[model samples]
Target: MAGVGLVHQGRTRQYEVKVTAYVLFSCFVAAMGGLLFGYDLGITGGVTSMDPFLIKFFPSVYKQMKLEKAHENGPYCRFNNELLTLFTSSLYLAALVASLFASNTTRILGRKTSMFLGGLFFLVGALLNGFAVNVAMLIIGRLLLGFGVGYSNQSVPVYLSEMAPPNIRGALNMGFQMMITIGIFFANLINYLTAAQENGWRYSLGMGAVPALLLCIASLFLGDTPNSMIERGEYGRAKIILHKIRGTQDVDDEFQDLIDVIEVARQVAHPWRNITQPKYRPQLTLCSFIPFFQQLTGINVIMFYAPVLFQSLGFGDDASLMSAVIAVAVNVMATMVSILSVDKFGRRVLFLEGGTQMLLCQVAVGTLIALKFGVKGEGSFTKSEADLLLLFICLFVAAFAWSWGPLSWLVPSEICPLEVRSAGQSINVAVNMLFTFGIAQVFLPMLCYLKFGLFFFFAGFLVMMTIFVALLLPETKNVPIEEMNSVWNSHWFWTKFVPQEVVSDHSSSNCKPSP
Candidate 1:
C-alpha cells in the first residue's frame, strides 16, 4: 500500500488517513470520562451551598453560613469547616491513590476496559451518594466516585490521542476537555433547577449516573486502540483496526510505526522505571509539571466552589447558583473554541494567550473584591460590583477553558512514546488529583485568611506557568505520536537531553517493516 510521506523536523514519515465516522464515534464515547469528572467538579460546589444538603450533612457549616448572612463579618470563612471541605477533597485523595493502580489496568486490560471500570464505579458511587443516610455513606460514595475518576482520567486522553490522526489529534484530544466543560455546565444547571427542592442535592448527586451509564454502554462498543492491541501482541487485529479507523487499506506505514514503538515498549519490563531514564526526561518533566501547574492555576477553586464564591461576594443563594450556571456556560463555549482552533493555532499560542488573559482577569477580580469588601471580609458588594465580579470570573474561566484546562490533558497524552504512555498518563492524573485535593480542602480557609488576596496568589501561579511554557515547552502542533522524540531534539533546551543520535535511531527504526 502506498502512503503519503511528509517531513517534520527533518524526519520523514508516511501515514495516509481521513477522519471517519467510526473514529469520531469512538473518540466521543471515550471523552465521556471527562464528563464524569466535570460533573463531580461542578456538582459539589452547588450541593454544598444548598440549604437542605448542608443542613443535613454539614449542620455546622449551615449554621456558620446563616450566621455570616445575618452579620457581614468573616463571610469568606463561613464554609471553612474541616469536615465540610473533606467531603469535597476526599474524592481527589482517593483518585490520587487509584490513579497509580489504574496505570496497570490501562496497560493490561486495555483503555476500553479501564473506561468501563470507571463508569461502573461512578454509577455505583452516584447511586450511593444519592441514597446516603449519613456522613459515612456520603464519604464512602465519594471515594468510589474518585476511583472512577482516577481510572477514566488516566486512560481517556491516551485513548483519544491513540485513536486520532496526527493532523487532528489535538482537536480530538480536546474532546475530553470539551466534555468536561459540558459536564460542568449541566451540573450547574441541574443544581440551579433543584436548589429549591427538598432533596435537590440528592438529585444533583444522582444525575451523575446518567453520563456514567452512557460511557459504560459506549465503552462496550468501542475498540481498543491499535497501539494497545499491538502492545498486547494482537498484531493482525491491530492492523485491521488501523485500516478501519484510517478509512483506508493503505495503512502499512502507520502499522509498521506502531509495531516499532511496541517492540521498544516490550523491552522495558517496567514502564515506570523506563520513563525515568535520561532519554525520557522531557516527557517525564512535562507529565509531572503540566498537571501540577494546571491545578495551581486555581481553576478548580472556581469550578468546585463557584456558587460559594459568588454567595460570599453578596449574591443570594438562587443568584449564586444562576451565576455558577452562567460561568460554566462560558466555560463550555470557550472549550468549543479550543476544539475548533487547537489543531489550527497550535498548543503554545493558546497557552500564552489564555494565560495572559486569565492573569489579568484574576488581578481585576482581586482588585474589585478588595475595593468593595475590604480584605477583612466585613463589607459586601453592591449589585453592580457583584455583577462585575461575576463577569470577570467568567472571563477567567473562559481563558482557562481554551488553554490550560484542555492543553494540560492533550499535551501530556500525546508527547509520551508508547513505551511510557500509560505510566506518564498515570503520573499526570495523580499529580492533577493531588493538587486538586489540596486546593479543594484548603481553598475555603485560604479564602478566609487571604480574602481578596487569594486571587493574587493564583495569579502568581499563572505567571510562573506561562513563563515555564515560554521558556521550556516546545510546540507539539502536528507531530506524530510515535515520532515525538524529534520535537524534543529540535528544541534548544530539550535537545540537550535528547541526543541527535537517539532521535535519528528512533526515526530510522520506525521505517523498518514489522516482523
Candidate 2:
C-alpha cells in the first residue's frame, strides 16, 4: 500500500511541474521558423492561385492556358507552365540539399545557432523574392528559401524534443506544426485582401521576413540544447540549461542518465555509422517510412494547391481562397486535438486510429470526385455536391493534422538515439523535403492530365500507410531517450502497446539498468 501511494504521488508530480517562462519563450521563437515555412506556403500558394499574379509574372503562359481552359484571353507566353512549377518547387530542392548537410551543421554549430542561420537565410531569400525584377532572380530567391527550410525543419524538431519533458513533449514539439498552420491561415488572409492588386504579391511574399527576423533575433538569447552541450563536454553548462528548461534543481539523476548513455556512445568514433547496424535497423526503417508515407498521404497536395482544388470543385476564385482560409483554420484546430490527447493516448493508438481514418477520408473524397466531377473535367456539380466536396477536403486535412502531420516530426525526433540523432534526423527530414518537391512538381501536371485520378492515387498510398502503422509502429510516449535501443530491439507486433509496466518489465531483460 505504501509503495502504491508513493508511485501515485510521483506520477502526480510529473504532470505538475511547470515549464519555465524563458523555456517556453525559446520554444515559441524556434517554432517561428516553422511559421516562416507556413508563410511561404500561404504566400506562394495563395498568390499563385490569383489571376493578377499569373498575369503579371508569366503573362504569355497564363494567357495560353486560359485560352486552352476557356477563360478570357490574356497576354500569352508558352514558357509560363514550366516556369511556374520551377518557381515554387525549387525551394524544396534547395531544402533537400540543406537538410542533407544539416547533420554536420547542427553538430558543429548547435541547434540554436543553426536555427539562427536558417532564419537569416530565409530573411534574405524573402527580400530577394519580394523585390525581384526578373525570372532568374525569383528562382534564386526560392533556392535560398528552400535552403533555410532544410536547416529549420531539421534543427528545430531535434531541439524541441531534447528540451521538452517526455510527458508534454508532444504538445510542445507540435507547437511548431501549430505555428505553421497559424502562419498559413494568416498568409491566406493577407493574400485574400491583396490577391486582386497588380503588386499585392510583393506585400504577401515580403511579409515572410517578419517571422524569420524574430526567430533569428530570439535565438541570440537562448542556450544550446542539453544534448549538444553534452557532446561538447560542457557538463556544467548543460546542467544549468537543463535546470532552466525543466524549471527544477533536482536534476542530478536525469543528468546522470545523460552521462551514462552518451559515454557509452562516446567510445564509437563514427557514431553516425551505427544507424546502419543490425540492431538499429528497425528504428532506421521506422524513421524512414513514417516521413515517407507522411508525404504519400498527400497533405502537401491539399495544402500547396488548396485554392486551385477548390476552384476546380466549382468555387469562384475569391471563394476558393476564402475556403482555403477555412481549410487551414481547420488544420490548426484539429492539431490541438492531438496536442491535448497525444501524451494521454500514447503514440501508437492515435497514429493507428488517425491513419485508418485518413485512409477512409481519402477514399471517400476520391469516390466523390469520380461520381460528381467524373474522370474528365467536363462536368460541374450542384451546390450540395460542391459543398460535400469541400467538406471532404477539409475532413482530409483534419485527419492529417491529427495524425501523420505532427507525428512525422515527433516520432523521428524522439526515436533516434542521441549519438546519431542529428545525422538521422537530417536524413529523415531530407526525405520529407525530397518527396515534397516531387509532389509539388507533379501535382499541376497530374491535374492537367490525370484529372480526377490523382485523389485515387493518394488514396491507395494511405491504405498502405494504415497497414504499415498497425503492423510495425510501437508506442513511443514518455519512453526514455536512452532506452530507445531497448525499445527497438524488443519491438514485436504488440510489445509496446501493452501497459507501460509490462513494456518496462519486458524491455528491462534485454538491457542493463543505467548506473
- Per-residue lDDT over 397-490 for candidate 1, one digit per residue giving the tens place of the 0 to 100 score: 9999999999999999999988889999999999999999999999998998898899999999999999999998999888778777878887
At residue 284, candidate 1 shows an lDDT of 94
Candidate 2 lDDT over residue span 363-472, tens digit each: 88778777765654555667788778778878888888888888888888887777678767987888888898888888777766665677778888988988898878
| Pairs clashing within candidate 1 | none
RMSD of each: 2.5, 4.9
* Candidate 1 Cα misplacement greater than 4 A, ranges: 1-11, 69-73, 504-515
Candidate 2 is scored at a TM of 0.90
Best-matching candidate per lDDT: 1
Instruction: Please state the error at residue 347 of candidate 1 in Å.
Output: 0.5
Stretches of candidate 2 exceeding 4 Å from the true structure:
1-18, 69-80, 493-515
Ten-residue segment with the worst summed lDDT in candidate 2? 1-10
Per-prediction TM-score: 0.96, 0.90
Superposed Cα deviation of residue 277, candidate 1 (Å): 1.6
